[model samples]
Target: MSTFAVHLSYPSSPPGMKLVGKRYVSANAQQEGLPLVFTHYTGAHKELREPAIQKLFDLHSKRPTPAIRKAWAFAGNHGEAGVVNAGSLKSETNGLLHSLLSTLPPSSVSYRAIMFVEPSLITREMRLKHKAERRIAPRSCAR
Candidate 1:
């Protein structure tokens, strides 16, 4: 998640450098950037990750094509902290989500804190939609 945040928080890569395979690789990364990029996404859902796949393309909209959009692997998704749905509010997660939200602005960092501290094979896509929001951290955040 931090990788995704850092990617959005900064400017694009330099010429000849491309954001492939989660790192700055040569634009000619033919090896990693074959006809398709095969990656793995892990999370909570136990079904085929269609939305998760779509969200992957949504997040990395650098120069996407229909074929390029056809992802093969690599994803790690979760909910806004412990709040996966309205039902989550009925459990102890209720108090936790409220407290965490009160303290941190809605961001992946905060979400990661409440849950998703480890990598998993599960893939769960939250039905809630979060419009893309990219920004520079405030100076106070630097300290």
Candidate 2:
């Protein structure tokens, strides 16, 4: 059986690197290797959020033609005590989505899930579309 794991590492990535530093679970179940996904989400950027979300939608809509899977946004605005929020930035989102799309499973040719800490574009109405968890931390937790 394949094991599924998702690691959360907040405030670990440095600036200008382009990734949010969220740890990825290993499908091997016996391997100790993990990877990071980058996003461009910043809680404060209302302008960028809409476009980012739209871009994500476009990316995911294409199922048979190169799709996106899991993703993470880099910390855009760091809160007190080294707490940064990177859940909707373009640079970070693009990076993370690109990585996931490149490594999609053969059986599943398209995106099935999108993970983010906080997505400004996701309105309250959209939340009801799926079984998503919304909160102060990790904004968009949809699958």
Candidate 3:
């Protein structure tokens, strides 16, 4: 099977959601905080190959996963505007290399904290890298 390293982040929580003991809870008793509602931002290294990732994103963007759809519905039900918006996928070739190099003994890869940023804040190079990554094969580059 193909293995991929991915980073995901949520820029903001729903309006009524509150951080309670490291978990988000909704003001509404019937609904809980949708912490897994991370349809907004995602990043992947070249380990997954660019075209495959793009195709996956295209397919899912048109028809989001069940979890994403549920998050959208939850946002709408709570009248939380702007919680669900079009997000971007980044290609972090340099970041990926850095992450790999930062790895210590006994572990093949290093874990980096997720970064939360506004969709508008994403750089042009990141977008361009995303495009370029999609064209290259996942295993073609140095691992």
List the candidate numbers ranked by lDDT, top first.
Answer: 2, 1, 3
- Deviation of model 3 at 42, angstroms: 15
Candidate 1 all-Cα RMSD: 17.3
Worst 10 residues of 2 by lDDT: 25-34
Model 1 TM-score is 0.18
Candidate-wise lDDT, in order: 0.29, 0.36, 0.29
Candidate 2 TM-score to native: 0.24
Candidate 3's displacement at residue 15, Å, is 12
| lDDT by residue (tens digit), candidate 2, 1-143 | 11122223323333333322332222222222112244444444222333444455454454323333333333333321123334334345333323443455455434434455554677777877644443433333332
* Model 2, residue 105: C-alpha shift (Å): 27
By TM-score, highest first, what's the ranking?
A: 2, 3, 1
How big is the positional error of residue 127 in model 2, measured in Å on the Cα after superposition?
1.5
What does candidate 1's lDDT look like per residue over 80-125, in tens digits?
Answer: 2112333433432223221323555556632111212223532344
Q: Write the per-residue lDDT of candidate 3 for residues 68-118, one digit (tens) a residue.
A: 111111121111122222121121112212232244336554432233434
